[model samples]
Target: MSVTGAGAASSTPASGAGRRVVILRHAETVDNAARVWQGHKDTELSETGRQQVAAAAPHLAAYRPALLVSSDLQRAAATADAIASLTGLEVRLDARLREVHVGEWQGMHADEVRERYPETIAALDRGEDVPRGLTGETRAEVAHRVGECVREVERELLPGETAVIVAHGVSGRIGATELVGLDQDVSDVIFRGIDNCHWIELVESSKSFSARSRWRISGWNLGPWRL
Candidate 1:
């Protein structure tokens, strides 16, 4: 849950009596375009990614985010910067929001990884929570860290407020599973990976007894135009 930044949330929550958290995936990156394992690599966004950020920024800004946070990686941080530009809030950086670390697979193409670790890939395809890249953290490990970040974000939020977090695909999806008390086994299939620049919306119930008194998904894999 370690994050770095400064500033207070400035706006009121949307017409709701709960804490809303948006976990947004970073835009497309050079490695993503090449189908390479981006895992903890400091890859920059592609040109299409820039355009994506431009389109997606407005939707999130419309939420009138009280707190803005992002992964320290450039891809996510850069995406967060766009939203900050629209809202005039400093982006808090957190490493926990980063994508799964690929270990030996970092920067390697998907085909190369398939050739090197067929069974591992197969297990992953079947949604097994094995350690990634044979050396990196397990899915549960990522869920724990990112879920901790979500909890920390929750503590920073006031009732009836919104927080926008710029993060990566794998982490964001799995983390949302943890945030909502879902079984870790459902990470890959239940909430499938979101496209670049898409986002997951979660609401924490507290203010009103009318709403379900637990965290729940409000929307998922949503793009700017849809929301």
Candidate 2:
């Protein structure tokens, strides 16, 4: 496995060995720039988004990610491609890494969704599972799948190895919270959210054959501007 900036931020004491997992949100997309809901939409990166990657990849290179994994969606894959080139690693694709599926709301603008689906928007804000257009996965569903993805990767990791996961916003947040052992409500408040191309580093360190219950969330929102 590759190594670099995969450190989990946790308050729990360390005992056994643990690995780091970096969860990165894909770069900006045309839909993102337009404030459109891109759930499961195969959107490409915007011009600005490509520039974001060009500027951000070098900073990420410093982390020297050992294994690069990404959502099968083009936007996320494109961003992962930049890192793969920099780190000389191949990108592993997983559909479970894709963003939350918003069903009928794909391509709709934020204002349009807020106006037409006020209850739906409110439900999301409260961390409730309200379908965004008569059909969509609930918050619990998103958390379950993404959490599984994180655990699967974590289980595969040997000591000092790090994996970089490139995905979308909501799913990324869910993954981080789940990995950190935070409940849904608490995670919603703590993670808040991530911007395009930003990333969260969750490190799981263990010592003396004892795994700590708490993981850490360091390096939050590491992005083009911040990096």
Pick the TM-score winner: 1
Candidate 2 lDDT over residue span 129-214, tens digit each: 67656697877888899889888888786666778899889899888888877888876775557878888887764432434354
By TM-score, how accurate is candidate 1?
Answer: 0.89
TM-score of 2: 0.87
The parts of candidate 2 lying over 4 Å away from their true place are 1-18, 207-214, 224-227
Instruction: Give one digit per residue, the lDDT tens place, for model 1 in 1-227.
Output: 21211112335665557788888899999889999998899999999899989988888887788899999999999999999999999999999998998888998999999999999999988878788899988887888899899889988988788899999988988777777788877545565677888888887766445432378877777775431
- TM-scores for candidates 1 onward, in order: 0.89, 0.87
Overall lDDT per candidate, in order of appearance: 0.83, 0.79
Task: Indicate which candidate wins on lDDT.
Answer: 1
How many clashes does the backbone of model 1 have? 0
Q: What is the lDDT of residue 46 in candidate 2?
A: 96
